[model samples]
Target: MASFSGFIRKSPDARLAVFLNAKGVHAPDDFNWQSEGRGTKLVNDINGLIAELPEGTQDRVKAELDHLASLATPQTMTAAEQVCTAQRIDLEGLQGIQDVLLMLAIDHPKTLERVAAQASLMQRTGGKNWSAFQFEDDGEPWALGDDIARAGFVTDAIALLNLPEHRKREADWYTSIRVHPITGEETEVLQATIYVEARAESELTFGPSEGLERQVFQRVLEVGIACNAKERIVEICANGGKKIRDQYASSFAKHFAPQSAPPVEAPRRDVLLNALLSNPSFPTEPADGIAKVQVSSLEFYSVGGGFARFEHLGDDETIYQFLERQFGAQSPIHSTGWTITGATLRIMQTPEDGTGLSVSDDNQCRFLTISGDRFNAAQHGRCC
Candidate 1:
């Protein structure tokens, strides 16, 4: 039986300990082969195991044990640097081989050494490119000799690709930047592609032409930013050039067409007049920043909707126009055809738009309301 304490300084020694442990040695702590008289037993055990193995396996195990003994020298702590002295291995490459060596120390020392040598070679030569590998004209992809050879090639290629310089070369050209207006957050967009296709036969005049035609189209993506208010998309580019258009019978037939419908227009005043006379209430104050006039009954309607707010300017003019000019004729303060009955007040054509006024019983003209087909008195209140 043997014990390992200081003797188990590195992976090779650890591998030896595992081997010894599996053999029912009962290896104890503070194990020193020479001082504790266990050295003879250990040697005898190793010899017995080797004698049982095949000749080739015996030789390999013996050689590896010898190598491990040599590696136990004091300076072996830095043995990796000594072994890879002139070889150029990137940190990643060095770490990869080191991991393999540690993992296989017990049974595959020779393989570990071979892999390390190959890794160093790749580090020096910057790895072999797959495209540069020669292939047989018989249609085979590549001739990498055997599975082990292919693995080595792939390992080297991975090391090279992990380098920052290699990655930059493979990165796409255009970088997209997107920012959220509300949060002021930015995001990077790696790639965006727009595919365009056309038909070959569509361009032919007489008989059946060729098959389908596809073309590569490239264009710039423009982004704009504005402040103080929200931004809106004004337009999008659709043309993929003339050759593409001709092949697709004057347009890209595969692309979806955007459908746009016209805005719904407000109902005409004449139609709304009857509804107003019956209900006699405004739906809502005109959209904020605009004023509207409404007449509940025929008497108010006869006065032409209580004279639109900015009437002195023209029949077609509105308060918005008056404010823009900043020099318009004063608006007349004539009766807005409003009449109060109990708590409810009725007025001519409801102002379709305005910074709505609040109404209460105590406030003068505060109970003001409007009646018109367009206005629903029940729905309208102080602007939300």
Candidate 2:
């Protein structure tokens, strides 16, 4: 196969990727169905693209492409691995049934076929802590979750980054690609993750600090940015960027980069409070681009007086709900990125009424730390 370059050339915003990727190729809305004998649009179009590609290049990509296509099959574990290697499995001590199946597949298709085939006749074992299969052959322990505490954390990490919106993996693999907008340079991006699993407050606690809950999710996302941000930061500093190298970096983000430690932000807080209260946008979500959407939770501590106030709006509720449905549950149904499920509510100190939820009325309460659930785990923890 010969190499050829392709370009999307149009989209600057990553949000417009789908349209950009599919642009320039005109297939009949039904053309792929007619041409490829496939009823699916995505399938037919992909096949059409490969068909048009130079021959050798298609062969090179054929295996990789085929593997990706199988994830949609929604196959079950037991049937896919014909050999009932073990009835009980420990995912913690062991990786997972899927991991074992992966190593077996290279040598044992019979094992794979049997396991993949028997999707319906399956049973589960183990407590909420773990599960075992009733289809025990040879009493093997090819199970998973013996290390739910650790594996679950890693699994959660993979879920947050490699997959978007929680999609299943393909053939024991998760695939993703990043493309440079200007150069059309398609490159593989390796995903990184920071761990977050449901743990007791003691286990979850890190740093002798505040906002233990939000830190859980923040670490997960920082891993994503660290993949690219670290070198970028170093590059800027090495370039003799005076503002970051000498000014903000020393006082701001660098101080709090570590989860186990944080510097006192009293000085920064004083400076920040002036700008934030004046603009009230420094602490805005996105904290950068885009207009504020909806304020779900707000907690404020007045420096002049010791007090705390809390207010919550449901995910879809607007700030003006005082005029309407004010009594409905105000907490968030789900968190934004960390995927920690919880009812998000704002904590604020405001003029108290007998009917509202209780919060400190003293103004001296001063902002201890602004916090909320990143993963919405609060609701789960509460119900549990």
Among these predictions, the greatest lDDT belongs to: 1
What are the RMSDs of all candidates, in order?
33.1, 24.6
Best by TM-score: 1
Error of 2 at 44 (Å): 10
Clashes of 2: 44
lDDT per model vs. reference: 0.30, 0.29
Ten-residue stretch with the least lDDT total in model 2: 2-11
Q: Which ten residues in a row have the lowest lDDT in candidate 1?
A: 225-234
Question: How much is 272 displaced in model 1, in angstroms?
Answer: 99
* Error in Å for residue 42 of model 2: 10
